[model samples]
Target: MTRPTPAPKPSAPTGTSAAHVPLRWVGPLRISGNVAVTETEVPLATYESPLWPSVNRGAQISRTVDAGIRTTLVDERMTRSVLVEADTAETAYAAARAVHDRLDELRAITRATSRFAELLAVRHEITGPLLFLRFEFSTGDASGHNMATLAADALLGHLLAQVPGIRYGSISANYCTDKKATAINGILGRGKNVTAEILIPEAVVAARLHTTAARIARLNVHKNLVGTLLAGGIRSANAHYANMLLAFYLATGQDAANIVEGSQGITLAEDRDGDLYFSCTLPNLIVGTVGNGKGLDFVQENLTALGCREDRPVGDNARRLAVLAAATVLCGELSLLAAQTNPGELMKAHTRLERLTGARDAR
Candidate 1:
């Protein structure tokens, strides 16, 4: 009998062992939009095995239609807020006015920090003697977290020199609202604002999803809209947007923490005749094509596979990536909502898939 080999020791830090999560490519999802027009399989890395089939179901439905999932780029901007202190509110107000007036100079300063960072807007709020300046920028390709922060640092120095009586308080004022569930990101927008929508025929819905258009639409109103409101969810009305977002973010090497605000979105469903019109509007879908995590071997391969690594204009690749992310969100959201429409279907699928995964692990 052959002797069993001992488990290899981890070369990484003790706590940072190479723990693996199961990753699978799901769906040659047909997506049509201003940014991307392709049938692509998405890579999702997650322990939740049910998501793969759930999203695959939605993807199958997409292919039945001519246009498939339609993703639209609503808006795009990355923001960073810097804090400064003045002697009085009057001085703070003066500094804010000066900053607003010298927009050209500030744009130059922001550009000097990074070739990709371009100043889009500058918003300021003054309370007592404190000034919070939120600087929004268009960062090309990269997600623009570090880029925005670096630009904000340089802009802070410039503001201190040009605007008198305001000294540095902090680099981030929480007004940018990065990685946290806040209404500001939803209202003013922080990252990629993309909406993914699909119109499923009544026959397809009943055949694939085992539900009717009216049932799904009514469920959306009662469960997603009203339930979220009753729960006091801030700027969010959706079913399991974070589930798909996290899986996609992990596979594509995005800042996974961004799912906090990335998950804040609305699910709109309508009973159009007998067809089902499902849409997901994600205002804070933060993703990047070339960033910190893109250097990873798997991330590079995944981006290339997704066609996000194509040599496009500065922001085009990132926009394509954002649109893809939004479409994936819709796929998962639609499938889960459809499953919930039938009693015990959701739990049965979860229990069955998770058990299969566990059995495989045991093997």
Candidate 2:
């Protein structure tokens, strides 16, 4: 009998965090009494399947991640936007840039509170009398929509008081491109971009995944690249980066819709010394560690179990979580590509995990 073992904790999160925010509706908020906590051991994996137990709250994590993987923190940026009806495009642009510059000069780059906002870019567009400004900032640990909105309102107030001849339009002009896949997000780069790469020995690949490293490399090029290009995909071509991202996102209570940006990623594999060198780059990973549902019993327990509660230095916790997310995505990509190289492994696993097991559990 082949029983699954505890999943390897591949650089899991650490630290403790708790909160008592009152969810007030035009009144004082109250606590829910779900003080979720994880003491020391990380919950990298419990045991899980791709389907059925889709909630994945307590589903098992995988143990098949590459052991010799190297992850890099490439970039991290957050954005907020507003629309302004101004006399001219240049006028609105100057108004927004002035505030952004002022914020920059203060070097208010944050390291505390999940709501820290440090200006990154003040983007602008104009169509007739409508001038749109997408105020980009690094909003620490929170996925930052609320924080960014708050900052946008304040900036609009600032523009009204100082910029002259500019009136408010909308706090979120959709021009900011939140929860959408856009060339702007790809070009300017929103969220954290983390890259995970590894060299899998040929023997190991053959033994476990039943495919040679060289073959996996070629498969990556032909399938993910050429096939994806023919399909007219944008900024992505992989087996299932979103599979892992969605599982993790749901487990951690992140804004699920942001998976739109989260799925805007690339997977690369190369032939090297009879070993396959592979990497996955995830951009626009709008994830948070402190707010949203991080305080809930299931979400917080998962975050804490994953050791994702480092709340100091503002964005550090979020950055760490992004790296972990990227790494996990890489694991899933590698596993699925290996399965693709085989004939029936993918379907067999699905039938067994999703159908047979799921049905049996229902009984």
Q: Compared with the true structure, what per-residue lDDT tens digits does model 1 show for residues 284-353?
A: 9899999798887677878899999987889998998898888888989999999989999999999999
Please identify model 2 stretches exceeding 4 Å from their true place.
Answer: 1-48, 51-67, 87-115, 310-312
Candidate 1 has its poorest 10 consecutive residues by lDDT at 10-19
lDDT of candidates 1 onward, in order: 0.91, 0.64
RMSD of each: 4.6, 12.0
Which candidate gets the maximum lDDT versus the true structure? 1
Minimum summed lDDT over a 10-residue window in model 2 is located at 24-33
lDDT of 2: 0.64
